[model samples]
Target: MKNLLLTFCLIISLTATAQRYSDQAYLQDRAEKFDLNEETQNIALLQIASDRNKAIKILSENGLLHPYEKKIRKDFEYRPLTDMHIVALSRYQEQFIYLTDKAVLSNAWAGKFYIDHGIQNPKGMAIGADFLTLVAGNSELRVFQNGQKIWNTSVNNLNPIALEYDKTTGHFLILTEDALYQLDLTLKTMEKVYDGSNLTAMCYYNDEIVLGTKDGIQSLNRKTFALNKSNQKLPWTEITSLKNIRGALWFGSTKGAFKLRSDGKYDYYASKRWLVDDHVVDLEKGPDDTVLVLTKEGMSKINFEPMTLAQKADYFQEIQRSRHIRYGFTTDLTLQTPGDLSTGYNHDTDNDGLWTSMYLAGELFRYAVTKSEDAKLNAYEAFEAMERLTSLPDLKGFPARSFERDGYEIGLHANGFSGEWYKKHVEENGRIWRLSDDEIWRWKSTTSSDESCGHFFVYALFAELAPDKAWRDRAIHQIKIEMDHIMDNNWYLVDWNGEPTAWGKWNPKYVNSFPTNVGDRRLNSTLILSFLQTAYHFTTDEKYKKAAEKLIRKYGYDENANRPATTIGFVEGEDLSDKWNHSDDEMYFLTMPGFVNYSFSEEQKTAHFNTVKSHWEVERSEKNPLWNYLFALSGSKNIDSEESAWWLREFPMDLIDWKVDNSHRKDLTKIEPNFRSQTYSEVLPGDERTLHLHNGAYRNNGGSDGNREYAPYIYLLPYWAGRYVDAISAPVPN
Candidate 1:
């Protein structure tokens, strides 16, 4: 009866606290509620429209506007598009025609469903000069008029595998393995155009037969029957299909895909960012600057137009609301839905506590400045998720890495997991956790120190700025529990297996073991100082201060805390030298803000302030808006407000992880030694770099792994932080 009553009450409590979010609905409502000049809605919208028009006019006053449409990601809609071995694609006026395997599908406006008119064993197809559809088979050629076969015949002993129509002379051309044939439809005569055995694909351009063959790309003259080779060479071995999209040639081959450059060389588009699969079976350009490619996986649309910054930010926001934000914290994802893109796209995270804490920090700042109730709800939602992490262990204050289903995870399914990992699960309370029989969940054991640092980092912000008294009290309560747990356990986060998780150790044996110049020593020392500062600031507890003083006065940790800002760049033989640790840089900066802001006195504040300033002095060249604004907030001298704003403005509006390489470019500026030892072309990080994690700031050339899309938090954190701190005004929505 006791357990049942407790369970009954717990259900009611959890039910009462759970709040579902409707982001778009809530934001739309909030925008209405916060809409400026609500009494004159038309007048306000008119003014905004005029302002937008003026901005556009000024942008285009001296230059002609090249109209384009940018593609918003619709990850799910393409699912129904299906993986087809697309052999040919062409646009006949308004109709979209494509063939895969032996089937042909015709649609209008690239619609999801085909028009249901199809052909069997379609080896190749094209629209003839007479506007009739011509399809070539293994040994036959057929002409169709308005979905009905008007003509079908066996070509006289010529194995026609591909077809092309010539508008210049009203003729049809055929491609076989070793020869090209030109058929005069008016005269009913066939002429051998080019003699080549390894011919792959052919198209007529400017009255010349442009051919993609095994050796190279060459043109055949009809009258002379002479082959003139271009300087271009095939990047791939076997060119499967050739397409004349808007007069430019696009080629698909076994190795990758290509578009012929004006200089006659081929530009390869093999990277996943460009193609869903590198072994592209087919490609076509559709309306609105859309490049559609087909592979073994499915068809994908590529947007040639780039977005404005505002659009990129909007894209980021939509992705966060729709895809990346899970349980109110930002994390990576493996799969997502398409169509309206209104799915959760939820996935588990190993660093749930850590990642959530950073996102929580962003929302806290956002709500502090904008006073948006939605932002507050978002923050608290994450806060609730985080609170569950700490309390699940029932080990006073030990935080878990994550929680998962009881047996769904096959191995080590202990602690909400099963399978091999179950062996390491330290049974506390009960093995089945009578919370439920089958629904029994487990919190992950052996959480990392970075996760611990992250929790303290956000709790400091929340303790002071939670929108409601309940949230504020919860923040303070969680802070004390976590701090006490660490202090009681002699400053280590004890894991489920009864040992400190690999990175959570901060004892003297761990701290003093590293030489003074070591990065970890400074990093760990800064982390502890910040953690202690945060705990004391929230609880006004003296023990936290005393613990901090002993580390500083006894072990020279304060000196170590000041080491990173001075020691990070261009130096050799210093402990943990040369390799840029962006993650550590992230932690160092993440912690310092709290440590300096909540320092017990002015003297301590000044010293910490200087450390941040020195650090900023070195980091200024990176042109990251987040770091600049953070430095400005930290009281750094000579911090350029315009530079910070420039960083935000220059942030590439496209957040998709397209593998970008500027190393081969003839236009790049000279590379110089920045602090990171990474060669930077004169361009700023925000302007030219790929969409990367915060740690990827210094790397100029690299491909993104996975689907490589990003949550807008990186942009949002800095954009809003600048707005909050008055570093940069938000650009008006266009």
Candidate 2:
């Protein structure tokens, strides 16, 4: 008798725990009526009594509701339960939906409206008439109403890889690797739909279910289950990923990415030449229609905008204006100023210098938009500046080596002064110099023979943009000289002279010595391509084309070959020789050989167009947003692919943490004992960190005071990618 009593007690406790609410307590006290099905009536009665225990436990566990002590109250009398009542109760129980109005009649379930949250992992989610379902890694089918998971069920052998909804039958179709299953909620069972293929992803469109796999993409009628391969020519060797954005379907593979069109065709992007390291992990469309691509190496955002004829005409006028400035015309001082006479026509912080090279680039853009003579003349002036700058000294002597100026000595110690002085010295005289203190403690200048590629791009731009015979001849002459000065027997630019001078012995600047050489392949390719492109623009010279092709082939023209898959010898600020000292360096360098093949191709346009796309991806991830913008400017036909627009909209410059540290160095309190006997003090202050953006260019985290300002030119990115319009369009803040 005692054992029986204990069993009864245990049964009662279990029953109490299972109960969802108190039995119709509120209904008995209220005048309003509620009619529900037998099961829902029981649930409604329990819910009225405010059974906190059961509802709280279920909602919290399902990630539906936060735990709160607030009680829910509704005044309604009880009525007969029905099917609609059961469905209504189920829908109300979901966390995503909220009750705005009570059911008007007993047993009615159609009074509430539901809003949906944006889809998460939508590529694999199964859609149904009233619900969406997804299987987690644990093989549980979690049913969601309005983006809130209502319930879940555990099923074995159902490794669902893709999902689609059959609106006609209100059934959810699940695509597994081996078979397909159709789930019927009313029957509480799953039926075999179809079988026989390695399915990867699925989507529902226009009463058809689309399934993508390794073979190809196929469509099936939702009700009939009739399968038909899509007419589109999808190059899917291994369809590893898929996404649907704004009614468009995107497919990804080892080769590249493609978008499905309305007429059942595929448009390929970032294949062959244009994707940087093509192991795509994710693809998304932003709110502004920008395409965001995340890859194994980095992320890329693309914006495409179409160029209009009116815009082209405007660009031509700008090109004509630039030509006037280059040819020594007195223009508005605000926009174009002659080179400073005192500084020998060097570009300075005062914005008085013509910056002929920059203007040349602008001219090229005009020529590209509308082939004009003025643009060609401006381009020639740019080449002239390059020729003159090349004759300047490669190194200026301070306590340490610095950029040269004045053809004699280093410039005075001033912030943002060295680069300007160097520019002035090179522009005026055909000799590199350093400004220094003489025996009398007065400033003196000296000259040197070392050379650099500081202004080489000017010649390259002119070679491409120049239309007149004089401009073309001058550009060719300058190119040959610059090439002879920099290129070694191996075709790589030797960093410095090999002879000793009065100031110091000649030292070869290793690849790591200057930030500019970190990606030497890109620099060389840009220069070679510039020449080839210019030749193509002019006399259609096959020799130039062949030369460019040879260089690109030797380097590796494609995106994959240009990037190092592994993180070896890739340390920032380390000399190139030291970084690539290990065996892996050879492999990393080997990847760049695709450039050669791309450059040599005789086709007017080949897969090499993809190279721009690839570099944009790489640059985006490299913390250089400008390059991405530049790539879009040149490669994209429309602004739809630009990430810059989104950045401007969502993330403002004020949110960025910009810091600068300027502190004196204590370690340099005393000069070296050996050099103490020298006439001038050699002590230099500690490096300062600051942010400076001038002339539509920016530098972040600039190191040491002397070297605090760094332009993004080292990457050969947007500024040097030959997108003249985009380069000039960069907004300069007041």
The backbone clash count of each candidate, in order, is: 20, 66
Error of 2 at 173 (Å): 1.6
Model 2, which residues run further than 4 Å from truth?
1-154, 184-189, 205-208, 214-236, 253-256, 261-285, 292-734
Which candidate has the highest lDDT of all?
1
Please, what are the lDDT tens digits per residue for candidate 1 over residues 340-410? Answer: 12332445556778878877887887787779887798899889989988777877888877665655432
Once superposed on the true structure, which residue ranges of model 1 sit more than 4 Å away at CA? 1-274, 281-283, 294-298, 304-348, 404-441, 495-498, 539-542, 565-582, 599-733
Report, for every candidate in turn, its global Cα lDDT versus the true structure. Answer: 0.60, 0.36
TM-score attained by model 1: 0.58
RMSD each, Å: 15.2, 26.2
